[model samples]
Target: MEVKMIGISKSFGTNKVLEGVDFELRSGEIHALMGENGAGKSTLMNILTGLHKRDAGKIYIDGTEHYFKNAKEAEEFGVTFIHQEMNTFSNMTVLENMYLNRELKTKLGLLDNKKMAAEAKKIFNELHISLNLEAQVDTLSVGQQQMLEIAKSLMTNGKVLIMDEPTAALSETEIDNLFTIIRGLKNNGVAIVYISHRMEEIFALCDRITVMRDGISVSTHQISEVNVNQIVRDMVGRDIGDFYPEKTTPIGAIKFEVKNLTSTGLFENVSFSVREGEILGFSGLMGSGRTEIMRGIFGIDRYDSGEIRLNGEQITIRKPSDAIKKGIGFLTENRKDEGLILDFSLEDNIVLPSVDEFSKRGLLEQKTIDEFVALLLKRLVVKAENKDVPASSLSGGNQQKVVLAKWIGIGPQVLILDEPTRGVDVGAKREIYLLMNELAQRGVAILMISSDLPEVMSVSDRIIVVREGQLAGEVLKSEATQEKIMNLATGGN
Candidate 1:
């Protein structure tokens, strides 16, 4: 179950994604693929899995030259790819989604519900996953859906498993369980290709590492042979100094406050405040109603009873537009569906929030918009050919930058960032953090909801822990510790 790809080259029209990249994976070992956004890591994996045809390349599986016709073919041949983006039928039950297109049939060609349920249960049990088979996927939280995807991939019993940011949506406990399962698979001789921007995870879980940059594989080293700094330098081709920049902004009076916020079954009596020029971190286990609270505040969802105040003045935000008009911006965790319109050009997406500002006398001002977009793109260091490129054309990290750019265009007084650096690479993450510092210096209050504990601890001026839809505890950055926060989040103290 060894795979070797050499001299791989792929291009989409004038844009070349991968050029002469080489990667190798051995059986029973986890090989990591690390790269900055748009650095051709996903493109290489897509080429290997047959999602994209390589214009020129050599693929050898167990010393045999071969290429899969499509992803299905690759899966059937014992290569299963669990994409970063969860693939599930929202309307279908969890069990139905698990056995989709590969269901067992009776002698009379009837669907075997009993057999399917048993098989699914067996896999879920082995993986230490607790899920309601009868529940519709849409009703499940993002973390549950992510775990379901991993369980489904395990059911395939593939020889080579490709996991892309598999723990992005998982809680600490779930991530531990997943790591244990992955280790078990490795012991069973299953080769794994682990792709993630989280250096900690890579160093903790992988055996070997390959760094890619600008459409080529720069270096590959054993896990013990390289440090985080070395890997980052290889990926970004420069020393990006500190991982989290120091905060210099002075805190002011309360800029944004949520008082006695209550949603029917989501969150209850949640209250918090962010001072001007302050970055407040929201820490919680996945599905602990953090995102729900933000959505309620942003007017994407209704709260049964709540008070939102800005500058000590109570305000009514019944809709997203209303929130926007009140100088509030929201960067949702689910960026693909809510943050950016995928098919729209980068310029259009960046200017969406400030459309009226670029209009005069009921007429759109094209030059003003173009200038604003170009400036934001440059400021954000968005890696795209031009502002006219579709939002979908950029990589995940670049797409996130574009989302932030749009919020910046509006000059928001308060910004709500949910999982702001979820899938972003190290280099882009620093840039975003620096931008947050800059915004804070300009007196913008930011609420960052994140699952990455290290990130939250490093960037936040203050942190509030949420558990089971309530505010569990709050601590200043100087006084907070990971154990303390986790204890608060899990009701230990």
Candidate 2:
């Protein structure tokens, strides 16, 4: 199969996102699309998959002009898309979710449960994924759910697949399995369009790379001709010297401590201490109670038993507001849900947690808020036309910066970041890392929970692992390795 997109242009209201972009993919090859956040990567993919209509473009599949009215039309033409967001029915079983639209049927026109389960098992095995087909989709881990989404796309019998950051939530082993599956698909002559921020993966898995910047196709190069730094320069138009900025702060006394934390079935016996100017990393498999522990500590989730001490003073945190009042901040794992108010302006979102600080009596001090917003925008290097722009108008990386700024604006003593760099681009990841180091230098105790092994190892002073809702082990920065962390996370001694 040969797919070509010519002169594609798209816009959202007044903003021109994609401007006459042209690209192509050939059969039996993996072509990667690289760009910064909000560079129209997702928009272009949506247009290709028929979720959004392009303002101007020509789509040809196998030398014939094609029009996709909807995703079903694309699927019918052997084109399937696996979105960055999970698009499965959480209430349904894994098999049911996989075969929702095209289910196996019996001669009597009834659903064939046996055949669906068997086929699902076969697909899972072929992908080297271990998931219970009968389990509800919501019962699985984020990584398992992602695998199910991939399997769902593969079931379409498509010759072309569009995968958008498919490995964002996957572990190293799972990523290897996905690459194996991609290799098999390539051998079978399937054309794949992969979108990701991981440069090493692009070099290892893709044959060609398409770079997009400010809604235009900058250039396309063979993977062999481009290095990670050059790719970053093409994507962001700037050289990011160090991906992980160094921290120059001296570690201080413990500022936040949790003892004997128990939250029923979520987590148990959780205890840890984070010192001022320290980056303490929490490493674990998906659904290993890492996020749950953070939620309990921040009072987002109620805990049955635990004691939280801030600077050696015990504090009773019964709600999120209480936690904030005690100088504790939490950045949730799901940014779209908990991080920002999409309808609100960037300034509004940044000042949300510290609105009171800018309030005069019961009313807001507009000037003070404006000044503060400007300062944060400068410090974070947020690129936007104006502060009045809606948060949704900004890129994913900028939106994440707003989330971080929101908490930092509150002047917290302890900050808990859950998957801080998840879904962000490479340049933005570096910015966030620098922000973390800067925060630590200012006497903030940081608890960073991440599934990205390299990130956990690089940015942390100490690492803790959780397994099956229990504390697995703790290792210092010098001793934390892929083998050691995985061994502890999977219950090895």
| Best-performing candidate as measured by lDDT | 1
Error of 1 at 253 (Å): 1.1
TM-score of each: 0.98, 0.93
The global C-alpha lDDT for each of the candidates, from Candidate 1 onward, is 0.92, 0.88
Q: What is the lDDT of residue 141 in candidate 1?
A: 78
Residue lDDT tens for model 1, 38-156: 99888898889999999998999999999999999999999999987778999999999999989999999999999999999998888788788999998887788889999989988
- Candidate 2 ranges with C-alpha deviation above 4 Å: 91-93, 132-139, 382-395
Worst 10 residues of 1 by lDDT: 123-132
Q: What TM-score would you give candidate 2 relative to the actual structure? A: 0.93
Q: What is the model-wide C-alpha lDDT for candidate 2?
A: 0.88
